[model samples]
Target chain A: DVKVTQSSRYLVKRTGEKVFLECVQDMDHENMFWYRQDPGLGLRLIYFSYDVKMKEKGDIPEGYSVSREKKERFSLILESASTNQTSMYLCASGVGQGIVLTKNIQYFGAGTRLSVL
Target chain B: AQRVTQPEKLLSVFKGAPVELKCNYSYSGSPELFWYVQYSRQRLQLLLRHISRESIKGFTADLNKGETSFHLKKPFAQEEDSAMYYCALKDRGGKLIFGQGTELSVKP
Candidate 1:
């Protein structure tokens, strides 16, 4: 079984504060992703990392950055958290060679619900 | 650009009734489609994929290229089957573009 762990289940931050959401996977997957879930909007990708130090922007990457200094860990950074940023964040990891997207099977963490006040 | 569309945001059915959740996509090339489910307090997991052509948890979906739809169906709606279902499309780069998702509620 694959295990994807998010560092927090519930988080709270003030406006204009910096926030970090951490994720770790035990499956040694090569691809990691961060997504935000909102009502009626589904899961929107924030950022993704294919390899260490390699990152790509997803559909909703504004005001957010990601770090992948190691294979097992991926971190999402909110530069200046705002009330609008309050939402459920999810992290997923997939085992793929990074060449073909269809071959990748992603496993997701439990998710972190963040509240920005 | 690849896109996924799940028209229904919510669906309700009585137990032992048939249920269907509609999903459509707009992709220029051949696309890979997937269905994912998230139970209460559980992480999102893959329910099934078009390539595999398998039924999972009594739920099955068929890809219709003509209509560009992949609708999930089940003969009987079980209370345990109630969950948030998402339809996703795999882009050329392996990134998944997801639909807005549909919440299924099976009334006993």
Candidate 2:
């Protein structure tokens, strides 16, 4: 089984403070993604990385940025936290290509619930 | 517009009763549909995909291109089967769009 771990299960930060969310996957998957889930809106992608040092913006990338320094690790950075940024952040990793992909099913972390005050 | 719509926000059924979660999509191109489940205190996981044409956990979903719908159904509901179910669509592009999700509750 693929194991995905998040740095924190819960986090609280003051507004205007920078925040860092870390994720690590043991399966050495090439594709990693960061998504924020909100009530009624479901899960929206923030950023995704196909390879080390390569990042692509997803639907909602206005307040977020991502870094992939290593193959097994992906990091999501909020330039400055705000109350509106409070949501459940999830990290997922996928191995190969498109939808029918055998390894494309992303293995998700337990998710980090961030509360910005 | 390319989007996924899960009509029912919440669905409740008794144990051993049949249950179905409706999902519809509006996409002009080839569509790939999948059902994902997130149980309480657990991470979101894949339940089944239309491409595989397989049933998972005794649940089956059939993608009807003519109607542009992929609804999940189970003959008998189990307490453990209750979870948040999401219908996702993957266009020809690699990106994915998910529905609002349906909260299923199985009562004993």
Task: Highest TM-score: give the candidate number.
Answer: 1
Candidate 2 local lDDT, A1-117, one digit each (tens): 999999999999999999999999999888888999887888898998888998888889998899999999999999999999999999999885522334347789999999999
Report the lDDT tens digits of candidate 2 across residue range B1-108.
889999888999999999999999999977888999999999999999898999899999999999999999999999999899999998555766789999999999
The number of the candidate with the highest DockQ is 1
All candidates' lDDT scores? 0.93, 0.90
**Candidate 2 CAPRI classification by DockQ:** medium
Runs off by more than 4 Å, candidate 1: none
Candidate 1 chain A lDDT trough over 10 residues, lowest sum: A96-105
User: How do the predictions measure up, each by TM-score?
Assistant: 0.98, 0.96
Give residue A63's error in model 1 in angstroms: 0.3
